[model samples]
Target: MTRIGIVSRQQESDLARIPHVVRLVEDAGGTVVAESELRTADVVLVLGGDGTILRAAEGVRGTDIPVIGVNFGHVGFLAEADPESLADVVARLVVRDFTVETRMTLAVRVTQPDGSVETGWALNELALEKVERARMVDLTIGVDDHPISSYSCDALVVSTPTGSTAYAFSAGGPVVWPNVEAILIVPIAAHALFARPLVVGPDSTITVVMNEMGFVDGELWCDGRRRLAAPVGSHIEITHAEEPVHLARLWTSPFSGRLVAKFKLPVRSWRHQERP
Candidate 1:
């Protein structure tokens, strides 16, 4: 029998739906397990929005545990299935009838000026944003030991292709498909002309140095969930993680289809005339 691990959004309404979801999985001859018992499970079912799925990803990092997400919140871009398809989702889980797709992740390391260091990972994008709004954070960015440019900016969004459509996109970065193996760098509200969205190879290491003379410090946000203080003269580095996030999918649609569906992009052309 297959074991299904469950992780929910934890909202009152989302929690209420778990009973029905568990019942469906049980009826399909699957056993439900806690997120902590993932070692014994074949797959994990996340019942929430993208944020919940990202949280689950963090737990299963460095493991090949495939996570299947059911959308229960607004703009569930990371969710592979909808809440209405709970029965199908359960059936697929019991039979192990799904494809596991790997998405690239970023391993982030922060070295404070005081010689302290911290390391973390992000499933989406890891952002470095201003801690104080009074002044912009001064940053000097580079790639693979080669200097690129330096300037003051509101934030610097370092993202994987899986994250390009997220904060990177909102920051005027290009929407790179998830399959593309690259690290995307986008400077947010940069005060310099040389700062622009950049795409580097997956093996590249991105480095950012916070200028010591800056008026305020910056904060390092991992998927907008985890945080670390980035003081002046701090050095931050990002690279493709060794372990990628695994996502189980029942749908065979291409990334363009997913993008169109998620953004609700109109495909109808001017040639399609409405009957008068």
Candidate 2:
């Protein structure tokens, strides 16, 4: 029997609904497990919003198991099915009828004073922002040992192609296809006139060196979940991770359609807006 692991956020109702889903999986000749008891599993099922999926991915990283997300909350970008459609989703899974997509992740390392270092990784973006007030922070950026830009801004976002449509897009970055082999650097509310987004090769190394500002420093947020207070003069290093997150996609929904559906975008073409 194949083993399936289920991970959920703090939502007690999602946890409550697991038994029904587990019964569905068990009826199809599979065993269900939880992350705590999951030493080895064939696949993982994530329940909650995008944040929950991100957290669950971290737990399953370095493993070959693919993740299928079930939407229990709003804005579930990673979920494959809604709560009401979980039975059909499990039926599809039982027949091994799904495609898995490998998504690149970013690994970040921060060099602190006295030669100390801190490290983390993010599936969406690694953002550096001003602390306390929204004062502009001075920063110098470099890519693969080459100087890129020097600017003062409220924040800076380093993102992967999978993250291009997330925070980076809101920061005026381009929406890159998920399979694109590139990285994005976007400046937030920058003072420099030339602070436009740049897409670099996947192997390139990106760094952000913060300059000293009055008594205020800045903060670093990973995937908008993990937070770290960064002192002035700290340097952040970002690079593509050696491992990628494998997501089980049961449908071929194009990224364009997802964007339109998620954002409720306006249709400009008369054909789309008008009856045939």
Candidate 3:
């Protein structure tokens, strides 16, 4: 019997549906196990939406256990299967029938004046943002320990290609395909002349220095879950992590297809317009 682990949104949005999911797995000849015993689990089923998937990403971060998402939220971009396909998904999960796609992750380190180092990791992004509204935080951006520029901005989002579709995209960053290995830095509402989003090589390291003289201190959030404080003169370092998040892909469709379907993008070409 395959040992299966299940993770759900903390909001417990679909509490009523969990038992049904369990029954499906049970009927499919799989045993539901606790995430604490993740080492023994063959694969993990993540329930809920993209946010829930992000929350579950941390649990198996440095492990080989792959995650398969079931769409139970508004936008289920990260999910491989929908509620209507639950029975089929459960049957597949029983036999571990899926391909694992490796997605790059990021590791963040926060250095305080007291010489204390705090670390976090995320599958989406490492965001350094002002704690208060209507206030911009001052930050000095750099690559490989070399300073690039200083600016007062609402936030600085450092994301992997896999994250380009999440917060980074909403903040005016380009949507990079998940298979692309790169880093994107988008300065949110920046007050600088050259505030365009930057794409960096996968091996490059990024540093963000927060200005203590600014009106508000900043907070560092890893995938919107783990958090660390960034006070004045705090230095934050970001780099591609050794560990990658594995996603169990049921369909071999191109990522572009998922993008168009999820966003309901208009595909009508102007060249195909009927001439009057």
Q: For residues 1-276, could you state the per-residue lDDT of candidate 2 as single tens digits?
A: 778888887868777887888899899888888888544777888878788888778878887778888888787866778888888888777776789999999999888655678888888899998886746789989999888888888889999988887899889999888878899999989889789999999999998887765345888899998886677888888999998988998899898887777668897754655668
Model 3 global lDDT (CA atoms, 0 to 1): 0.88
120-233, model 3: which lDDT tens digit per residue? 888889889888988889988999879999999989999999889889999999999998999999999999999999999999999998877777888999988888998778
Local error of candidate 2 at residue 58 (angstroms):
0.6
lDDT of the candidates, in the order given: 0.91, 0.84, 0.88
Quantify how close model 1 is to the true structure by its C-alpha RMSD in Å: 3.4
Please list all clashing residue pairs in model 3, or write none if there are none: 212-232
Per-residue CA lDDT of model 1 for 76-194, tens digit only, reads: 89899888998999999899999999999999999999999999888889999998887899999999999999999999999999888888998999999888999999998899989
What residue runs in model 1 are displaced by over 4 Å at the alpha carbon? 270-276
Candidate 3 has what TM-score?
0.94
Ranking by lDDT: 1, 3, 2
Q: Residue 28 error for model 1, in Å?
A: 0.3
Better of 1 and 2 by lDDT: 1
TM-score of each: 0.95, 0.91, 0.94
Regions more than 4 Å wrong, model 3: 11-13, 270-276
Compute the lDDT of residue 104 as modeled in candidate 2. Answer: 94
